[model samples]
Target: MSDPAPRIVRRETHSPRSTAAVIVALCLAVVIAWVATEGVLSLLGLPALLLSPRGMLTSVAGAPDASAASVIAVAVAAGLVGVVLLAIALLPGRRARRPLHAEHAIVVADDTMLASALARTAARTAAVSADAVSVSLGRRTATVRIVPVSGTRVDRDAVRGAVTEEFTRAAPTRPARVSVLVSPAGKVGS
Candidate 1:
């Protein structure tokens, strides 16, 4: 009987939302520390001039009489902060590339690594210099652009097949559709 295939384990990673949560927590901590310090100092009969809670509230209460320009500036600053926070809350964090299932352990490759590998494979298959190839790896697609030698014609299908083969060997968890584009303008001296 054939041996059973080993299980593949994926690597654990933190999401961007977690990082943002940590940042928010730290900011809250700072605010809490300031308020606590101010309250303690006030109780000790040595209230901070402008940092105390009462002082801060009074400052806000008095802001209505501030110059128009200053008010506008403050409003703009607050708006910017709100926009940033909203973005952090709404934006999707970067997801690590899906892991490839293997016989033993799961394998993962960065998008850049996949692009480089595809580019190199395409270049070799097309018999062109590596610099003449450009590759873009997306979540569901891999695009390879190749510039053939000035006097030679490159077979697009051949390049595509080569890149696809290489991609299969890499064995990404999610298979990407391969696309090969041969540039109209060929490179000279390469």
Candidate 2:
């Protein structure tokens, strides 16, 4: 029998670059639209919305002579904005997601779903209700919070072992460190 071809998946994470770019484009468009409107109004001998294009150009041309400090400040602020936009475009954005190891298929798991599964497994192993267990899955850590039922003893080791085993079996590309937290007080009727 021939082996199945492995599936190729592009592990692309969500990024804020597109949103930022759109915001920037919209802002620029608004500014351009305002300028064009003002210019047309001024040419047509109509009252300016805020300032006529001729007056705006004159003020901009004379801005440097108004105050050297203000000019420098504006230049610095513009430069900082440019740098920030550049960094946003160049830096990689990450999400709370990881790829699971599979033989011939690609599988990505969200952190929330992964946490739920781990919590369910831990809860089942501890013989407690699902609500008794809470899991917080982070980029490099998975914290399990367990609240035992009243008058029932919960073994932290067993819960930890079960969660660890489940996590290992799932085999995420980036494995998270597991930490179990057992509440000192047990909940009643849980």
- Considering every candidate listed, which one attains the maximal TM-score? 2
lDDT of 1 by residue, 32-118 (tens): 888888888888989595587788888899899989999999999989988998988886554555455466654655668768878
User: Please, what's the RMSD in Å of model 2?
Assistant: 4.4
Worst 10 residues of 2 by lDDT: 4-13
Clashing pairs in 1: none
Give candidate 2 regions above 4 Å deviation: 1-12, 58-87
Question: Which candidate achieves the best lDDT against the true structure?
Answer: 2
What TM-score goes with each of the models? 0.71, 0.76
Q: How far is candidate 1 from the true structure (C-alpha RMSD, Å)?
A: 5.0
User: Tens digits of per-residue lDDT for model 2 on 99-154?
Assistant: 67787676777778888999999999989999999999876788999899888888
lDDT for each of the candidates?
0.77, 0.83
